[model samples]
Target chain A: MNLKKPLTAETISLDLKGDSKDAILAEMVDLLVASGHIRDREAVLKAVLEREKRMSTGMQNGIAIPHGKTDSVDCLVAALGIKRGGVDFGALDGQPSNIFVMTVSPDSRTGPHIQFLAEISRPLNDAAVRAKLLAATSPDEVLHLLIG
Target chain B: MSGPAELHPLVQFVFQLGVLIVLTRVGGYWLRRWFRLPGVLGELIVGMLIGPYALGRFAWPGLGHLFGLAPGGGAVTPELHAVATFASIVLLFLSGLETDLSAFLRYSVVGTVVGIGGVVFSFYLGAGCAIWFGLASGWLDPTALFLGAIATATSVGISARILSERRKMASPEGVTILAAAVFDDVLGIIVLAIVVGMVRAAGDGQGIAWADILLIAGKAFGFWIGATAIGLLLARRFSRILKYFQSPEAIAALALGCALLLAGLSEMVGLAMIIGAYIMGLSLSRTDLVQVIQKEVEGLHNVLVPVFFATMGMMVDFGAVQAVLKVGVVYSLLAVASKVLGCGLPALFCGFNRHGAVRVGVGMLPRGEVALIVAGIGLTSGAIGQDVFGIAILMTLVTTLLGPMLLAGSFENPASGLRKPEDAAKTESKEIVLSFPSPDMADFMRARIVRAFRQEEFYVYRLAPDTPTYHIRKDEMFFTLECEGDTVVLRVTAQYEALARLVVVEEMLALRSMLHMAQENVNIETMEHELVAGLFSDDGEDGP
Candidate 1:
């Protein structure tokens, strides 16, 4: 898995806007499309939602990782969104989720998808890393904070 | 009757009704809103406070003049008493209507045994106490026998009120309690007759009438069985007649009139009037008019039940506090304990686990009007003194108070292994849509689809998501939670249909716990029921 490939300023939205989980997810999906990582927008959105159905992606520390494997995407892709006013994702801890990391990968691949999921989750689990990501004001600042 | 001018019974009744209604409603509201006590308890407390035995004494100069002291130590005027009696019948009628006859029939065997157990055990303890007291203090044997009869009584109304408030009246324990109480009434009537007859014979120095005992038993059984059978058979046809009157009010009136008619019939057949009212209610419970009838009667229940409870409170003197303490406390303890073990043990023997048995026992503890009637009969016949009557009253009050409390506890921590799931889906203001991959790799998942989706607490979300572009299964009649392609969209229903759904939804959650378990590979058993059948499909057919 290439951790550096998807960590671009264009794929990160520091000031995401959405009142609900779907809106937040949509905002992040828009970021991935705008960044030229995917071709079929509808297929990827459906795939992301399909992942959400299996279980809520919302984890502890105000974060959610909504990801899916689908034929619509040619390569592994990622997008991040931060909505300060959290949306309820039916979080396990019952807290509103503010940080969302949406991932789309090709259906033929298994190794990179698993490895990419691990790479994304490792730094997010740390309290200081999460604090820095949450404090970042711009997409550039968020990328620097995330990949640093 | 002794007042300067006998206030026209109507005028006196109006004032009495006004006071009773205000005190009970205000007091019930206060307790329910602030103190969180049961509404019925509030009514009972208000009745006690303002009754002639307490505050009514101070108001005797003016208010008491208007409300005449319960002439001759009995509570309520002849006019008000008549209304309260009607209220009692209405209350029982509602109870009967709510009784699920099909559920009652299912548990009839266990319910009957528990009822018999409750009657026999309570009778022995009560009669033994009376015998011991009689042997030591020169109390009459006839009085002891009468007291024994009183001990066999169980107040279904009190338990029914508390259970109905909690919505547990439809539960297994609730059905068992109702059935047992019905049996208790029948058995109590027979026991009371035989004992009362024996007392009468001994008092007159005449031999016991064998014919009278048989006749009394026959009458109680004949009335209950005959009325219930006839009522059930005629219920649907009677409901059809009510279709001529389209209004809900007309239907309610017809229902209440039937209840009143049955109550009168019950009295004629040597049975409690409420027994007939209850049977009448049960007969009409399955009719199409039941929902409308229930809604109509609810207003009447709110007004009338409070009056019945409050009047019951007014009957308590409390001035006999010291004498009641001397005789009432020990007897009340014995009475409560006997019913608990008696009803509870038989319930367990009949296959109810411990929790269900405890509920049955607690439900039977309250004695209410039935026990009071027995004591009243004993008192009027000169078979028992006023002190024993006071003891019985005190016992009734204590048991009534304790019953709702214990019954509430028994239901809260039911013996069922599963906990009551929170109605999270129901409480959610916004609809939530969940999407998942349709299980295509596993053939086993295909076979279990219908059973897995079969109606339970949770239902599949049928509607397409608000997003217009992403649509699937729009024309399908039944919402199978399946969408186009590999993905399926499942709408969350509040019902927790399976324990496995909880585990599946908390996938990341288990990761934390899995890390704690570190070395051991976790076995996934949730898909076993679906997958195991597929693995054995190729094997030769086994025993049927």
Candidate 2:
């Protein structure tokens, strides 16, 4: 399960324009729909928002992973966004979050979704990799940095 | 100029009740703390000490005899007796609610046979004692039948407590004893119904025959079976209806109202009121609402249950007991022997070895609330005199005290009670521990874990209010979750270990996300200011 298979360049945003957490999530969902990854836009958005309501996905170290499981998507699909200004996304360290990685997977499957999370989370833990991804100006650069 | 004014009967009765409650509570606490005996025994002893035949006979300056006998023969007045009767109904109702219907069904065959054997042996021996000692005219005499009925019930509470203390609750013998105790309660109620019916028949000058006895037994059994069937069928719908009330207190009150109504109906139909209460409770036992109802009504139970026991003690006449001391002692020995043989013999045939059989029998030896209730009924209804009632109390005291000691001693050998030694390994529980960085985090994770299980339709409730422990149950799967400081532990069997881990993993993931959310949303400056202001407030002077 290659992380690049689900997270493609078309689904990556180099500069996220959303000023808030919900706005950033909505913008990422739009990217997934535009890339023809998500069949039902509203269902995926609802699932993601519902999961966020239970607990914020804004993790420490300026990283956020907002994910949900729903039947709206046929398979695992992800969208990556970078907001340089760092919006307050309820991070554990009480700091603003800049990197947003949202994934929507089929509700019937669990293995690939977990594997995708584990693979994506590994590279984000490195300070150098995160710095390079945040500095990357193009969607292709961001995807390459994340997958590599 | 004038003699001290006579106190009104109602005022006198209220004074007596107040005194009785205070004395019983103090006595119960003293006995429990010092002797490690059940509080009920203390209440009984206190009642006897302060009863009309003892200190109560001494007249005070302003008041007459403190606990003077009522106009009738009983020690307590009609008003006190009425309250005691209500307390007994509550006792039976709670017992019904606490019954583990699933466990009862799981061990049904062996439990039923064991229960039947106990009732049969106890009844025969109990009745024979009365007849042999000239307390009754014949086998079917009211006193003899009452004695037999009184000996049939094994206090499930006492046995369960001892077994759990010994950590043998999962043993074959422990489960069998518990299952048999449930059967003992049901059968005891049925036997009481039969005895009441027969006694009433005899009072009406009807000729007693074998056919009449069968008909009476059939009627008693029919009523219990029919009521239980209808109650169980409607339990779920009844629980939903109760939920409509919303508040726990309101729901509990309404449920208790139903119990009282059913109890009254049972009395009207010639069976004991407790039988109706028990059936009502048994029906609701399977519903998730049991924990809520039990928690809400626990305060009322604590206040009233002791009153009932103390009242039973007050009813005991020492002079009468002294006259029948020899008879009571012999009768108590028979009671102990009958339960052991009756309950033990059936267990032997059901996969238990001799050691297991003896353990099961000894575990079932304690005769508690139900026996006292039956004896109380007999005394109140004039079916038995003070002497018979005294003998019943003697038997209860003897078995209750002896039961725990013998049961604890029986486990000293530490040998497998099961015929197949391999089965013993199945009783061991697999434990899973999850530690957090801080106690607060553990508490948060524990709450979420419990909520996760609840969402999956498990009936989750705290084991006790004072402890950070919970019982999670769904159908046959049961788990114990304990949260202490920075650690949370889940105890379950191997079969359910995967499920337990899955729940914890899902909850921890959720907690991780929640911590992130909290960090982003929470403003450190405002939170610190609020915390400092609240801690240093002037209103703190009145706080603990």
Best by DockQ: 2
DockQ of each: 0.01, 0.03
Alpha-carbon shift of residue A49 in model 2 (angstroms)? 16
Where does the lowest 10-residue lDDT sum fall in candidate 2 chain A? A109-118
Candidate 1 Cα outliers beyond 4 Å, as residue runs: A1-148, B1-8, B60-64, B70-74, B108-112, B123-211, B319-324, B351-360, B363-392, B404-544
> For model 2, how does the per-residue alpha-carbon lDDT over B110-172 read when each residue is reduced to its tens digit?
778999999999999999999999998898889999999999899866676676567565466
- What DockQ class does candidate 2 belong to? incorrect
For each candidate, give the TM-score of chain B: 0.64, 0.87
TM-score of chain A of 2: 0.95
Q: After superposition, how far is residue B284 of candidate 2 from its true place, in Å?
A: 2.4
Candidate 2's C-alpha runs over 4 A off are A1-148, B1-6, B60-62, B106-108, B205-207, B429-544
Clashing pairs in 2: A90-B520, A91-B520
Give the interface RMSD of each candidate: 15.0, 8.9
